[model samples]
Target: MHGGGAVLELAELAFRELALFAAFGFLLGALDNLAIDLLWLRRMIRRLAGRRDAAPWAIADLPAPDRPGRHAVFIPAWDEAAVIRAMLENTVWRFAGQDYRLFVGCYPNDPATRAEIEAVARRAANVRMVVCPDPGPTTKADCLNTLWRALEREEADSGTRFKSVILHDAEDVVHPEEIALFDRLIERHDLVQIPVVPLPHPRSRWVAGHYCDEFAEAHGKDLVIRDSLHAGVPSAGVGCALARDALGALAAERGGLPFDADSLTEDYELGLSLAERGRSGTFVRCRGGDSQGLIAVQAHFPATLAEAVRQKTRWVAGIALYGWERLGWHGGVADFWMRVRDRSTILAALVLLAAYLAMLIGFVLLIAALATDYTLPPMTPVLALLLGINFGLLLWRLAVRAMFTGFVYGRREAMRAVPRAIVSNIIAMIAARRAMTHYVFARRDRPPAWDKTRHIFPETAVPRP
Candidate 1:
């Protein structure tokens, strides 16, 4: 009886400490969300008053380009034989008649992916495949660097230069007008990013469905809000366009390599680097085509929990770990705060684990108290107030998330977003731990390998714009 009581007392003590940490972390996150919420509200109010912005428009008109400027689409493929053929064909059909060339980067060893790109290139006039000298998947950035060199060589040989460089993955569903949109906007903005809508798998709605929720809110509101604050717009690794000259400047700065070859999230780093260098970058989310669908780069995300965790682990390692070591905190106030927010994922996962443990311990303690008839102390007023505010903020965040998710994916997925939020939290926690284990203290004997997820192209025929 005495030992049981001691165990219960220790559990109670642990529960208190864990709850305090979780509550404090939640409050801090809530405060951060509140700031962004207030900023978004302010933006909407001004827009309601008929305010006009030069760069980031809420609804911009995009018409077909009249003999559009030269544009190059860069796709870095590694073991993407499954979907590369379909994606390439779709890109050719969608962007037909547009003055753009598709430059695909392939590895010498990955003949499967190279064959797919070659099969498409042989049919399309504008499609070109650049083979990397390296054997296998060195890094996505290394492939991109090879493609950049190829583009420069082609320009030198042909005496023609591309005006903008658009980045896309092999699994992307390219919008017909996105390249033209980039061509038009690249004159003013160094980088322009369109919405990235992750296609939810029919089978894994609860797992892949959460991505739709996240991208909906992020691309729909958070990025727009960032532009309103004149903050740095980090690239989503797809559906982003960079000006040719801006990229050239970066290449020159980095000894002819525009991308950081060692970085996991090279596209993301490029956007932030351009922003830090005072280059203009904007995000646009608007309707395109007669169907009135959003001009987003839709792609299939991971459907299984293991795949999701692996992909997110790469992201966690890239952004919160390598990103910090590479790009130290130096930017405007808004940009600085945004960087902190991005890096907070590590701490956020820690808090989530603490909160879950606290809940478990609390349950155990509650049952012990019930069995023993032992008295418990009253809740502290400070802790009570903190939790109360966090609850309100939680409800607000869920409502807002649902609103954004429904905006893009409709009511059914929006309702599912509530449960998927739990899944997302678990994935984040797992990814954080995995990132620390696999990437942070990784062995440095050999080069970092490209760890890309298997991609899927939509089997259904894509509708023409």
Candidate 2:
């Protein structure tokens, strides 16, 4: 009986401490999120006012050039033979008339991918396969650099310059109007990014559907606000175009290769580094009209928990750890604030874990009190106020998430976002923990290798609204 009393007392103390910590951290995050929401609302109002008179620009897709400017598309592949052929063929069919060329980087060792790309190159006049000098499994950035070198040679031989360069993954199902959209916007911005919609995986609703929800909210609401504020927009690493001049600027400053080979998230850094160099980036979310609902890239993300965690671990490690080490806080006010938001995910995950543990302990304590006759200690006034505010913020956050999700994916998926949020939280927490253990404290001498998850292109077309 005495030991039970002692254990009860200890559990209560732990619960109180955990609750306090979670409440404080979550309160800060809630306030930050609320600020972004309010800012988005202001931007929406201004956009409505601007369109108060003229026809909506979204009714029709952006005008395409009769002879679109010469553009280069770079896709780096390593052990991606399964999906490369389909992706390249689809791209060839969709971009049939665009004045663009495909430059696929393959490894000499990964003959499967090389053979697949080689097959496509043989049939398509504009398709060029770039074999990397290095062996297999080098960083994606290195492969991109190899492709860039090949493009430079082609430019020298053909006496033609690409207007811009687009980055894409092997699994992406690209929009036909993507190049035209970028060409239209590249006149004003150094880097132009489009939305990325993860194809819904009906088989893995919890693991894969969470990405659909998260990206819908992110690209739908968060990035829109960032672009409106003129803040530095992080690249989604796909569906993004960098002005040839911008790439040249970075390459000139970088002594040769524009991309950092050492970084895990070279594409994320590419846009931010350009921003640091006084270049501008924009995130455009526009309708493509007709069967093409949104002018964005669609791809299949990880459909299993293990795969999802593996993919996100690299993201957490790259952004939260390596990003901080390389690109510290050094931009304008909005840029700095956005960077802070990017780095806050890991800490937020920790707080969430603590909150979950606290809730479990509280439930157990409640059972104990109901079974016996002992009353628990009263809550602190500060904690009570914090809890009340947090509860309200939680509901608001969910509603906003659903709204943004439904805005893109329709009503049913928006409803799924509620339960899927729990799955997202769990994956984030595990990935954050793994990131801290692997990248944060690992040996510095080990070279960065390819951390890419296996590719699985959607076998069928993803139905668009």
Candidate 3:
């Protein structure tokens, strides 16, 4: 009898623990959602009422060119053969009249990528290839380091000077006007962040919608809010331009350390590093009518659900491991505010875990009451009202985005992605947690080789329009 009683007590304790944890998680999630809503409100107000010129950081305007600005398009590739040629073609066509040089970085082992780049470079006069030494660590940062060394050597060999180095992934098609935008922005700020949008893929799977959601929130609301308050914007990895002086300063400061070689998402880390060193960032408009902000980049979102999860998981892990840790030390008021933006997935995961446990417990209790013929108190009207308001905020925010971005998605397509986003976020949180834990727990280490995301582009995929 005592043993049975003890067992019951243990079970009760476990349930209580879970219930408390779950409740806390739900509250956290609710708060995160509220934060996003507040950000969206700030963005909308700024767009409607703010002066376009008054905000120096809003958009870049190019000066009339007597002498063209000296710049280089630094494209770093690792096994990107699937979309390299398309990117090159788009880049050349867009920046044809500009005074920019091309530096295509490739790994020795990636023969397919090298061959494609080589073929494209032959037709393009200004494009030059920098082949990095083989047995590379499959990270963009590593490629950047190799490219930077070559760039420094080239700069030494020739007396030529470059004003800025623009970074892009091999798969992205940069907007033609980005050069003009950067020219204006560079006159004021040392670093500029361009917006990223997924290439239009209507028939693409659930990943397309997920990408759209991210681009809308990150570029439209999150960045707009940051710009309104003069806060630092997180790097989109690609589509950003860095002044040559800033690059030199960063390299000098770190000695031989590759800026982004530590984790999967090197672009984000590089952006954060600049801010950590007291560099201010200007948000160049990448979208909207007659606005230079919507510089189109023909890039693919992960086509399969697994690819989406894998890609997001990598971001989650890398941001936690590299971004949070570096910012943890030198973070100021700006950093604190930005943490609310950067920790979206972490906040979402905690909330989902909490809400699920809470409802599960509530349902189980209600079922037991029914089976035992016992009268149970119904959930109070006040509690019901609170829950409804909580969900209302979420739907309103999502609906606002849907209305503007016009759902290229149907009911079946949209419905399928809803649960996938939730699951994908959970996986992302797990990846983030694992990366943070590893970084904290491990002692001395070599560079971590990340699991590569396999491309799932359609067999009939053509260049993005």
Q: Between prediction 2 and prediction 3, which has the larger lDDT?
A: 2
Clashes, model 2: 0
Question: Candidate 3, 449: how far from true, in Å?
Answer: 1.9
- Candidate 3 positional error at 267, Å: 1.7
* Local accuracy of candidate 3 as per-residue lDDT tens digits, 1-465: 113244434544444565556455555555765675686665556656855643334333344444457787888877778777777776787688888878888877888988988888899987888887766446678778887887778788878878788888776767777777777677667778877766546675445566765575567566766765666666787778887888898888779543657656777777777877778777655432265445645467776666666676667656754556655644666567667557555655665665566667666555655676443444446556556666675566556555434433334544544444555455555655655566566554666564556443333333354
How much lDDT does each candidate structure score? 0.86, 0.87, 0.65
Off by over 4 Å in 2: 1-4, 51-56, 59-68, 289-291, 462-465
lDDT of 2: 0.87
List, residue by residue over 250-311, the lDDT tens digit for candidate 1: 99999998988878788778889999899999887766656747778999999999999999
- TM-scores, all candidates, are 0.95, 0.95, 0.82
Model 3 RMSD to the real structure?
4.4
Instruction: Evaluate residue 449 in candidate 1 and report its C-alpha lDDT on the 0 to 100 scale.
Output: 81
Q: Which TM-score value belongs to model 2?
A: 0.95
Tens digits of per-residue lDDT, candidate 2, 199-253, equal: 8887987799999999998888888888877888888889999988889878888
Model 3 misplaced stretches (Cα beyond 4 Å): 1-36, 39-43, 50-67, 200-204, 256-258, 286-293, 329-331, 364-389, 400-444, 456-465
Q: Candidate 2 has which clashing residue pairs, if any?
A: none
